[model samples]
Target: MHLDVIIGVSKNNKSGACDVNDIEKLGSDPKVVELFKLKKDEVIFDDDSDIFITSGSTGKPKYAVHTHFSVINGVKGMFYYLEGMPNKENRRIILGLNTAHISGEGSGVLSPLVASMTSVFAPPVYNIKQIVQTIQNERCTDVLFLITYLYDMLNFKDIGEYDVTSLDICLTGGSNIPPKLAKDFEEKFACKILIAYASTEMMVPSISSPWDPLEARCSGVRILPNAEIQLVDDDGKCVPLGSNGEIWCRCCSNFQRYMGNDEQTKAAKSPHGWFKTGDLGVFNAAGVLSIVGRKKDMIDRGGIKIFPADIENVLSQHPSIEQVQVIGVPDERLSEEICICLRTKKNAIIEKDQIVSHLTGKVRLEESVPGYVLIFDSFPKSITGKIDRMSLTKQAIDRIQSKVQ
Candidate 1:
């Protein structure tokens, strides 16, 4: 077997790279060391080293290559945003995200490594009970969760049985954090929930401070240092403040390019170094940026357009709805129809009329109201723990077809 890289795992299960050139220096058996070590090409570590694979929820997964330069810069960016966070050195953060994923590596490992904090690896399974149990066992002071993971934890019936009070602050991103979920989680866990805006292609750009007001924490995020963000329209021109536009970001931590796909790389990145983040965002009068939805996820019903975030936000407020995802399904008359896929609270009962009635008064546009509602025990999740809208749409369409037969 040939080994290009070696990682040293500590007795405590923490991992770090082994930088030793000669394996025999550690007094290991010479025969065994020679058998394990094969003479390989001396690879140089530079700014274009491959590092991450994107979740690929929108389409095919892409390899996000980062260099030593980008990694260090990302750590610096996280450090800048987390500077004033409470008890930085004392933080024992738990990782709820998958370690191989960018959010997991960045938040669970890189961020803590920069901040001089401890990173606790959660169990392999992404179960809420296991996560809460790890938090209780480790007395974790901080943790990062995807919206789906956080929602599951908050809705867990037995979550109150665990002691999560040791948590000082929690971070979440990848999607708009529902306001109700944020409030309920904070109230129940008694910890400040900090929201961050970032992507695998471009590392941390902005994050809400621990001291931010609830509204600011939920809807707006403070821009971090060493990162530049611009909201641009379809023509790639900067949009006026308060107008929705595609989020374009330039940062030191930005990935070099998508491996093996020059077309995708060119489409997502500009020659000027700005990475088009596909996400739609807006800047308020206060210059605080808030993510609204994904530009590619927009639903066009005939000629009318709808952003799923607007509909999801309204449905998320329903008392019985634990988690909701709005997607566009095919329609013969119209170009597309709105479909609401959701998971209800434990043992909660909901009817189609009940869901429609819940949104009728709140949703302004009649077209925005869901044409179909599909309830499931759980929604499909991407590798990064995000709700997979594409898969959900396919599943909804298949179920509807089956029903027609």
Candidate 2:
């Protein structure tokens, strides 16, 4: 909410900072600006003020509340884990979109000031060539990647072009990435791509850094310090370490309440301090947590649980594939079977066998991959640009049901 009337001009160094007055000219109300200032000041000082990260987009944006103490706690955990990992002291160069979404705000923007001297600048618009050019020109050595953008970058070249030799790591998150994309990125760039899993509610909860063993990487990862992670069965009882259960996290960094919605705040939070993440997962042998998939999205195949991410990861590695999402479809034999909706750069006519054949080398066919492959022009994406799989699945179901009738 920026106002455009600076009568006097006396400045030390002309910084390109945008204050509230500047925002006012762009459509935000002046009152919103004033309220933000007041709230920020009060929260910055108040011991109980909640620190929140807005979801990258909204079906109703939940302001994840975290206190100053919580932010410090979460940050400490991140740094501690980084310290324990191999060669953790490298200075990082950051590229992020400025949307005030937690990933962009907390990881990309704030990390430089709070964590280290981050490479803070506007990023290329998911254009690989432009991104590579910037990286080469700036000599910024690392990146925190969004899956949608990372997939785009991988399609640009075979991985040898543009001083990629300097890149040490790329951290990707927000949602599941096709495993093939992960493998190709590693092979092409010769750097490990760590999978990151977090939400608006928790900024940086689960990270699989390059230093971890491969098995640890597939799981959601252990809860960071000061963060409480547990898996409970549908009955609300705590499950064993290796069991697949609904994931929950409780910590100081939790959001205060949804901005204007009280009911959602209540449902998302428990009286005992935990918040249901809505994700389902399990801890692997070494205590590393693996996100099986969304609890609501789990496909029941004749009673066997089918997590599409497991299969999507497998299919994504095919040479003909670009990106893919797996969803459950209703079937008489199994109640629910698997259907893969994919977008590819390899071929116009997709063959399900090719996907099955490609994935058989990586995993057993019976364990996870779908029986069918459905190709589409593109996906309906969320505000964060992640695929809106829920919508896609709904449409797929409608089309199939119509045929059945």
Candidate 3:
């Protein structure tokens, strides 16, 4: 079960000198020799097996084990939702994601191989200029960009200089995208933007289709075939439609288990094979699933449940705000209070009152408005590049404590 044989070792081999035959001899390669020396045991795997390392954004990263069967099933699901069969005429793709994670490994590497498509690996640094150059040069028909990367690309000063007319579809996920950003990207690029919802445990359960209506395309993803989704409340009871709940998913592409972490795996999976995604989401009347936020990220301010995404979405529209993260901080009176950390546009000046006014006009609930606001040069991110809410919350607490002293 040499998993490398499926996706090929060429990309994984840091040194271009290695071939399939030389995979076992990767230790001898000068480029990876030091890496092998430090983590030799972790690198070795049984033949014909695939190992996926979790991003560890929530806690310590875990090794997820996958077999050839699981990989095939996952790839099959990818093509199932695709408009048509992949062919030489329409198979060229640009992959901008890091191949270390499932999103990149599965969609960027394995899917192309299984579907016999040409996948152009985007530059490692994610330079917007270089990425646009590759897309224009290769005339890629399909491409996948992380939501954050796409945000930066949309804001790139020289974006209009590139000839991206060849792109047919652009896919993004891993976080909630502001509606304004999504709409702007579609209008600016003249290509269909497919917002996907997937996890490492469940390869890819849903992706909005190019043919979907603008509202559906902007609001939520359409659940893919052979995938089942159910929203459950605190007691594990399925929630009513259009109500927020923990997203539980069952699909053919589900991962086998967390390598050597039985307790965590058991806690995440149910007896019926449903994997609790730990994400709060709601299914609209149209059956489109909209991710609200992480259950752990929900702010309980005096028994009122506030989703950071709701605040982040509204604040993201502020012309001066480049990136914003809403978090909950401890308050003796209210148990928790909404705190917003903002990254402003260069040379942009924003006042706390301005943010309050913006939220007051946009957010329907008064409790949802941030009570505390802190400005930062930039938000701290985890290894996967997602906002580190935990770190931001700690920073907010420290700032509040310092003022009291």
Candidate 4:
């Protein structure tokens, strides 16, 4: 029940066997106690429990706790949905994700371990050329990519040079995939791209299956069996079907809590146990779920609310654009003005005027247009390889302040 007892009996403890007394002594030692006590609730899971560290894309990283039953349920759900897809016999899977995160833990470690499948891990730094070579050499049949990695691979200059004909199922998660990028990858690679929707809190709740229609496959995900999804407004009232609202999920695989943050755990969970995902989503008439954007990521442009994903999706279609992140910058008049930070393709030249004109033709709302466009060689990335909007917002603020001075 206590922390020391939990640590002493943890299966992951590789420091030889020890009892509760020894662990307590170690915890009491001045040199190591501070580290152990940094988080009040940082207790180890049971000996047989499966633990995964979150990517900390939003803030500080935390541990997500799962039991054997939960992990098995998640893996079973994946197999159940992927059962009828082609290349089911081909178990060679390429896991190009960071194992520390749930995306990697579930697909790379747990799923393969339970199913006895071969998982080809990319190098620590994940060189695109090396990954491409591995797929060709291993003849990997299934590959899971984080959105950033997917974009990088799709934009890789020598992508056509590699023999990637072996790929059957391509899955992407951690962030939304541009519809154009998904469609392009499928057309070029001759494989189905499944855009999965899941969180560290609830592992693999829904994923776009190959059974879905082509347009639905590219747009949203079908909720897996045994998982429940509810979309609720700011007042916690359930939204009508086909309307946008915050996504709340509850399922067998949902994590118990934020490892050491009681306040966060309380705030994220409702009385009925539905964990508030903080991301906005909408369900179609057919009940498939499509993510809109994060509630916290929405920008207040004067009185109107703007979702950055909308602008980012539009700009991502520009021929010269390689990657784009839309953020909000402080504005005296409008409260928050839209600022887009973009990375252009190699040897591509794009001007602010060109982007403005492009948006003018594509974006219907005048207010949705980005107030400022800044081109960057590369965007700041979090530990999980997501674009660090917080960092970019700070840089944008600094740039704006300097100009006023």
Say which candidate scores most in lDDT.
1
| Candidate 2: tens digits of C-alpha lDDT, residues 206-275 | 6775666544564456666667788899877899878899988887666666666688889888899788
User: What lDDT score belongs to each candidate, Candidate 1 first?
Assistant: 0.82, 0.67, 0.80, 0.79
Residue pairs with backbone atoms closer than 3 Å in model 4 (clashes): none
Q: Score every model by TM-score.
A: 0.88, 0.79, 0.86, 0.85
lDDT against true structure, model 3:
0.80
**What is the per-residue lDDT of model 3 for residues 1-405, given as tens digits with 9 covering 90 to 100?**
224333244455554344666566775788798776677666433323667877666777778777666667777777665526445446678988888888888887877776667789888765778988999999987888877777777788987888889887788888888877777778888877888888877888888877776567867888878689999999899998878999999987787888778999999999999999999999988898989989988889988888888888888889998888888898898898988888898899999888888888578575445778889976766676666677778888899889889
Order the numbered candidates by lDDT, best leading: 1, 3, 4, 2
Clashes of each: 0, 21, 3, 0
User: Distance (Å) between predicted and true CA of 236, model 3?
Assistant: 1.1
Top candidate, metric TM-score: 1
Candidate 4 per-residue lDDT over residues 349-399, each given as its tens digit:
988778787777566575446788787888787787877777878888888
lDDT for position 233 in model 1: 86
Q: What would the per-residue lDDT of candidate 1 be over residues 207-277, giving only the tens digit for each residue? A: 88677788788888888888999999889999998999999999888888787778998998988999999
Off by over 4 Å in 4: 1-48, 113-116
Residue 12 lDDT (model 4):
50
Ten contiguous residues minimizing lDDT sum, candidate 3? 1-10
With a 3 Å backbone cut-off (N, CA, C), the pairs that clash in candidate 3 are 1-47, 1-48, 2-48
Query: In angstroms, how far off is 221's CA in candidate 2?
Result: 1.9
